[model samples]
Target chain A: MRLKMDFMGLSLKNPVMVAAGPWSRNPETIMRSLDAGASAVVTETIAMEVRQNVRPWIYSKNEGYQNVRLYSDHALEQWLIFIRQIKKEGGTVIASIMAHSPSEMAYIAKSVYKAGADAIELGLSIPHGEGVAVMGSDPDHMYNSVKRVIQSVDIPVMVKFSPHVTNISELAKVVEKAGASGISAIDTVRSIIGVDLETSKPLLATYGGYSGVPIKPIGLATVASIAQSVKIPVCGIGGISNWSDGLEYMMLGASTIQIGSAIMTLGSEVISDVIEGMDKWLEQKRLRAEGIVGKALSNLKSFDEIEILPYKAVLKDACPESSCETCVVGCLVGALEKKNGNIVYHQELCNGCGLCVSLCKDQNFELKWRL
Target chain B: MNIRDVAQRAGVSVATVSRVLNHPDQVTPKTRERILEIMKAMDYTPNWFARGLNLNRTGVIALLIPNIMNPIYTEIAKGVEEVAHNKGYYTLLCNSEDSKEKEAAYIEMLLHRKVDGLIFIAGHLDPDLMTRIEETRLPAVMIGKIEGNWQFSAVYTDYFEGARKATAHLIENGYSGIAHITGNLRFIESAEKLNGYREALKNADIQINPKWIIGGEETIEGGYLAAKRLVRNPNPPEAIFIANDWMAFGAIDAIKTEGFRIPEDIAVVGFDNNRMSGLVEPKLTTVNLPVYKMGLTASRLLFDEMDTLSSTSESDEKADQKQQIFLPLTIKVRNSCGHQDRIKAIFGE
Candidate 1:
């Protein structure tokens, strides 16, 4: 399987890159990820000034994760040294930087470029970084800031967009107009995570960035939208834990994939698993990554353009063997019922939405597209 | 009115007026009375900020705790309050709810208010907290144990030793099949207790069953759920050593729900001899951590540091050194571990 792809004008060994996060906070972890077959390691977001992180910064839920992490506490000089060392070791390095202004970003970008970074990643929308981080909502500011960094640095610059933007595609276009080499969408979603009902205090006591399996839809949507709008490559991020998710993003037009939450939750070993999964899938499909990229976009349809075919739920033989009534209880139109220890479908009441087909845990219901 | 206005009306020097406000007995009775009368006439209230600025002490300290609802912390807060009140100082109780942001905010607010000192009852020492305390040169003490060398004075019970003693007591009671229910291991204290439990089992030459040891949230529900899993095991332990009394209470409830009698079917011992420990049925046998005394000791340490800081221009050398006070733990023998039953048999029921 040919996994290599051109991301931001740089030839990557694979489409999988370790996104800028705690996993890439230190030289050791960055090396670990690169050794585990990550195409490139994006360093933890660095800024001109240092920010202190909260204790117990990472909180994991059943569905996703939440963190109050601000940015890299390492000094810019320390990171520059790390980047220089990594580049000397023949490892690809993409420096991630966060700044409030275009000048600060451009200055950091120039320093990073001198330090031997292959590319630059602009961190614009850290959830807790309201004033200090980039304003993803302001397109003009984003375009200007991205443009300034691109102009100052000779390396390829990828603008990371936040999910909080009203029109993510429009923001992607604004950055593309500024000559951004690629787009990484989406950054962690802004969330409060949860609350302690007993104390009436929020779990983190403040808003934090949320990531993991739950936010994959939001990520795919942003990637699909941005890929459709911009000419540059789309790096799908957020909630990508498995290779199938990586494949799904690639099919939706993301040329590259960034893994952050999965690495944080499952460890860096998942990087190899994801790469292997993507390779094995490509091998089975007898296709290269470029063939799959943007393949789904051609078939993509708007809500009104979708062809809604009429269908009806039909009970399968396994319905009697399993006592599960999930579909019966979940059916909104009262189309499904359990009668005489077997599922009975009322064809007359069924709207042919085929929700039961997905809800049935035992594969006890099937959707007949043409009744 | 300002102090100068009161001084002008009283026809006394500002020093005499200041003396009357602070050390009234030092001033002559007639002079003090005159100063007081004029001050009342001028509606004069000494400015708090100005007073604090002059003395370089706010007569106020702040206590930051991870959670207020926990009884252990509430007891510590009470002890701190008692010491602060006796010293003629007020304490600002700030609950961080285990959030570093909230803790940082509270520290910032206390610093802004010119608090004389701070007492932190944190599970873990946040690096930012230590950095801020050092940067400001503020007098502060911690009522917890954190890994590595830190500058702040700390007052904590030897949780490892306490847990070991608790587990050893259960062993002495002739229970070899012992299970340990620990608090969240993410915390240093919980990890220490778990180590202590393992050490005790190792000393007794009993094989440590990994399945017997369950990690739980430091709450009653966490204990209940952990205990539920333990009792449902094919080979449940004859005795269980819980990390804290709150969880022990929950474990006891869970064991009872499983139709097991205390100390007869399964014996249980807990750490932290909380007030309710004695009141609970079967009176939990537990390690008595001097939590209140820890609070009192920590506050005293902070006060002393504040005194040292104010008295000496060269206190930086002294403040750089770490001050640690390790409190001793005692085991409260009770019926939960079936020890009191032996005492009752030896004497009278």
Candidate 2:
């Protein structure tokens, strides 16, 4: 029963950590998260100036959270003090910092490394809006900025990217060439939580970053792309909630799992729960947690390389107890039909998409793969 | 029949026969004539692909144009094809329709087919396509302006200078109430043209009427609608400078339909001397963009780039060799701008 692993030369007791967010804002919370189970606590995004978040910034929708929160309000000197205190307590701290320009970014990276930080993670995900485009959105800008910071720092430099880009893998390759040690994806997706019925204004009052359960798939896809594109270690951070969600990211070739919105919604206890669940599952399987990383990459194939087996939907037997017509009405190809108070399957109309198979909870429809 | 057969029939070596077909002037007239006679007698035709294979080249260059329907691009295509044909290369024209996805797909397809080079005749800035081209390390030349920091060569016309000259002609004609119908301002070329118009009015000390300026789509209908709005104003302009010929054509039709005489009531000038500009009634007084010459230059530059890639070592600074060429523009004064009336009055009528 070993769960220890190595990511970007940092020894971690486990693969799960607190991603850069409000959860890792101060020294007390960082200490609490480290005590709870987080292997490494990524500090809240630190910038040159303290930011003032709008009132009522967080909006809760179904299974997701949209927030307009910005960088930490604490000054850079205060963050360095917090990092120094945490390092004195023997807790691994990954400092996350951002700035408006490359030189400014390099300056902050140097300051954080001097404060006894184990590593530096560059946060270049904020969209500038208006006429000023985000630095991460342009490859040349991102490459120059990353290079400047890496040149100024002695510690391993990691870059967390925004998902809203032309080609995520292409950007990943650009940053890798710029001497990044690892990559993290993705920042919260640009989203609008909801609109007020009375005033017709957005719930967050403006467009904001959306995170939580709904963004897990998007995060997994981005992480998989980045992992495959670069030789550096990858940190997956998106809609991860439970241990199973973290495991899914590991399977996609991520070396570590980062939980942000989930910790905000459920509290720091979520980190310990993830670590315990992963440990228990690995122990039951008689395997180490590190062994599961990148196991699914071997099965991953390009569209042209995938072997599509022919499958046809089949209905089990006519039952008088059948009262559900969900699959029949939900079939996109009209392959499922109701006749004589029972479901019937037309083999000719079936495209084998398996939509109806999931719709029928009575186990009436199943897509049998043709050998 | 192969060249060997012709050579044997003519009692000569195969090299002599090849020389006759390729460098006929270098060979003796007797040998060349004898080989030609035998080839004509045997009804033999030279293989185009075999000739290309001799140089280890594809002999095919792909040209991606934003729109094939636009006469400006078609004129460029014609120039490109003319040069390619003379250089023993075939031109593969792809109409991208100004879509980033379609341009990417075409670039992928062209790369797979092993084209010798690529020529992109885009109407707007294509940053994504430029990134894709850079990733593939392809020998390409663009026929439009790239605004950002890109490491590629481009050939462009000075839209700002062209607009300034077009507007200056109106001011020189004593028209103080000059207006402009601009193309979509989001594009750099359109914005440059608008700036040039402003500079011309500023140099002439004429106040620019903000209400007279209207942004229109780069289409005939956009021009027509924009002109309709302009003419509906309480005080319409005496002269208008349209961004492109297509929009100018539409503006002319709209002004005529509104019962305004061509040069007497409202003088109109357009940009991009389209082929139909001369055929339209009153003819179009437009700026000659030299699109065909630009296509020729871009194709030639791509060929030179491919040659540089083949000759130089991979470590050479060939990838960073980028050149920017700007061809000059001239205003084509026609009847639409009242220049013809001045000429006729000075001569006879």
Candidate 3:
């Protein structure tokens, strides 16, 4: 199985990698993750000064991870000291930096590159409750920062974007025009981490960045939209729990998948699991892993161009024991039903949401278009 | 004799006899022959009034809406069409786009064309337009809320009740420090929605922080910008009740961009449960207004007024004065408010 892939101008053994965060905050943890089978390891986002973090930094809200603060506590000098060491150890190192000024970003980018970092990813976006004062969400700020960093660094430089903007594709286009080699998106969703009723205080004491399995759809959408609009390689960095999750990102035009909360919850062993699962799935499909990247792009269309056929979900007879109850609930248009010993679909009620078709993993439901 | 009396004597459908006189080719040869013989014997003639080609009325109604691209107005247009189709009237659909000049132009054009009646949802009631209507005594029914003292028939949803219910739902869900992003305060509907938001907060004993209330554009971008500003405050709102769902989308995305958790950090409720409300990420909790019914009722009322005008020349009467009709509202529970967290917890998605 040929799992090796090309990201921007660099060769990667696989598409699965760990993003910059607490998981990659230290040199030892970075080495451990690289040894655990990550194709590349991005350093924790280093800045000009230390960022204060409150206790209980991360909260696992059901299936989502709400993080109060992000970015590394150490400065650029600490990362420069070990980026060379990590590279000498034959592990791919991508320096992630978040700086306030364009010159500061360029200065950090040059130092990290001189320190033998294989790549540089400018941390342009910060999730809510996390920004000690970084500029990553705005397009003009992102373009200026990315431009200076790319001009300063000889190696491939990627820019990470936050999904907070109304149009991610527009920002992606601006970054591409500003000379970014690659784009990593959906840093984290800015979200409230719930509040304590008794004390009337936020559970995290402030708003935070939300990530995990629930954010995969947002990541997929942003990546797919950007990939179609621009020619640059996109590294999807939102929610990647396992191999199949990574595969979904690849199918949606991401050249690589950034594993974050999943590693924190499931440990570094997840990196190997993802690689092995990808190999098996690639063999099973009789295709290479790279072949699936951006395969779903051609079918993508804008909201207005999507051909909304007056189609309705209809139940077809299958085994009675089949427990794939995808069409039984969450019908926003009120189209489906779980009738006595069978699935019933109301043709008149279905608003062509196609939720049932996407959810029915067992192919028990069929959409009949009314011409 | 009238076409109906001729049809009874001819033992044929009234349509057959009328078709024989107005359109000879439409009726079959046998039906046409029998209808002609009966018409000749009974000396029957078609009734121009019943055919809705009344000598005095154009039998046309103009429907002026803010934006035809918007689904809300289109849904209402559907209702207006159904009533117009049944009443033997043709409809002229106009897109005003919330522009006073464009709306006035449409009104002037409809008047020049001598349209029998008009059913329109105005962003604001123009005094000049009202004066023209009063001078011409043209039958018009205003859709949605109207604030001015203009004496015109109107059919609108009780926006106050809807906005209040939406705010109450958020407060009941433990969301305090609520902020509201309403449409321009100049519109009567916007004012009513604002009143409801303030009333709900007052009932909950929460101080009305003047800073929390933002006069926003009626567009999605307007809501997004408003939500962004609200998030930048020293102490941001715990939840936001937007004037409508389109704005709710902007607010939700803005809040997400600002790194605040929804319902967890802040809950959000929007009015106007447009179809796409549920499809938006996190789903929008919104107030449901039956705009289609409002359009239907307004057109029906305009038809009544036009009928009275054509039958009797009563220019001014107490019973013929302008009337207002209010419809009920519902609060649709969805993800934004986090009110459905229980179900989300049970489902564990």
Candidate 4:
């Protein structure tokens, strides 16, 4: 069966999209991705005209990468133009906007919806130089920003979060509480590609947005955490270059996957290839893409939910009637002790955090699921 | 008991009581101990609002940068923060996104908050905003680029020289028909880089090809697109010098996709020497812009200005202004520019 995933109330033909960035800056790129088989295209973050050009270094060069600071001045007009073009081309467009203040974001969201965007993607996590240090990292700031935008716009609202924060689940809950309709798990993680040792300055704009296969694991971890934490549908993004990557996102609880840097490197043809490959994989697995959404999520457990076994009991169990007391000395948690000529467990004081699991040579000790 | 009651009990004025509480050493120890004992006896607490009103300083500094996505600004921010923290100052970092209006707003906000000083990473500073900054007489310093007759102190890398040296190195290596891929020329640094590119070509007696010079977005994708166009030409340049490392990576990717080997088919050099440059298969040879040092210098300048103003008598209206500081740049020889083997051979064990 063909996959049909739903985010909030919006329906998708499949769980594939083009995440916000340069990929969705204009109508032409949006149309290209749709033609290449993307279900939806999330627009770039629209900041206030004042916030658009915060620094010149924003225009600085990196290794070989360059991003034009094109989304400046008359952003509303540009958005309208792009939205109209996308609509004319029969593509679904999600207007992504970032604001200095909540009211401003809401105003932009309303205008974007009026301009014919299917949804408004509130970019709560854009790791711009000063923006990340100020607004991007704070949960309170993100919540208030989402709340203001949600109250201002009538259309469905989704917040794109940064994976750079410490707790994705907490941030997801904050956005949900603020009335966001859905969550797009992960904006680009803040990273410095490195400085030129010769010039002793940074390689790109001084600081470059890092994405690629290197960040896939972090994106997956954040998406999985957010999906399990909140009831809202999660749209996973970051380093999804192929169908397998897209499928992994779905299994990790993403209702949809967003393509960005991959398309930049591989071209729009990647969207079609990913979709075909995903469809083929689904058939082989006897499951639809939609079916995989939240599949692994049920099995996902929080760190606190893991039940760590008693170390002494585990060690003794592994070496039954043997005088190998190596595990007691190797134990860092002090949970293991020799009692009554045998290793004994003190479960009462054990926090069950599982720091002793790795120290043991035998696979006897395992975290049991607490009922 | 309130501060007023403590002042009355200690037989001292409210200002004296405040001075004792905030600047204990400024007051006599006998008087300070008397006030402290009275305050302790009465369990009196001083109001922060009133204290702020008297001090007229927030002990905060506003740091403005172009983009957070760029690690250079962030590293500069890290340096600024390090010195700011040492000086007991909190930094309010704002990303202007290279917009004059946003920078203006952030300046106003910081001023409204009564920040002690402002550290600005230069971009497009509107004339009106520059006028306002000058009129406000706020201690401000520019980092990364210097603009408009140096109204404020600035710490920047010598972009013109850095770019010139990089291009000269490439030219000396016998790379003819070198193409240049740079960011938007509207920026001062980009202009400097373009100038260096042209100067190197002129010095080498090689005719400049306008078609070879591609100005696109400063991104890997932009580099990829530019590389695609450059390489497809009937006679592409023997070597290409990209303005930034990010574009260089994209250009390399584009060249590889076209089944061309780096250095062998077409030598490439990028600026910024970003982290991924050395890690990449061929590695990247590029100019280094000392972001952290620039940030530290800018921040230190601001603090030094603030200190001078604070220490100067209120009657002395005229205060000495700090001058701009320009940091030097050096090129890192890496594999991407075909210097890997040469360097290794020279430094053989």
Docking level for model 1: incorrect
For candidate 1, the lDDT comes to: 0.82
How does each model score on lDDT? 0.82, 0.81, 0.78, 0.73
Ten contiguous residues minimizing lDDT sum, candidate 1 chain A: A127-136
The digit string of per-residue lDDT tens for model 4 on B234-269 reads 988888889888888899999989988888888888
Tens-place lDDT per residue, model 1, A1-371, is 39989888899999999999988987789999999999999999987556568787878888798888888988665687788778878899999997655755776787789778999999988767453233677898899889989878788999888888777778888998999999998999887788889999888856688999999999998899998998998899989999999999999999999998888668888999999999998999899987899889988898999878887777767475556778878999997778777767678898877788787667766777655
TM-score of predicted model 3? 0.49
DockQ of each: 0.01, 0.01, 0.00, 0.01
Provide the TM-score for each candidate, comma-separated: 0.52, 0.52, 0.49, 0.43
**Per-residue C-alpha lDDT of model 2 across residues B194-276, encoded as one tens digit per residue:** 99999999999999999999999888899999999998888999999999999999999999999999889999999999999
Fnat, model by model in order, equals 0.00, 0.00, 0.00, 0.00
Which stretches of candidate 2 lie above 4 Å from their native place? A127-133, A315-323, A338-342, A360-365, B1-349
**Candidate 1 residues B253-313, lDDT tens each?**
9999999999899999998889999999988888877677677667756765775676556
Candidate 1 clashing pairs?
none
1 or 3, greater by TM-score: 1
Query: Which ten-residue region of model 3 chain A has the weakest summed lDDT?
Result: A127-136
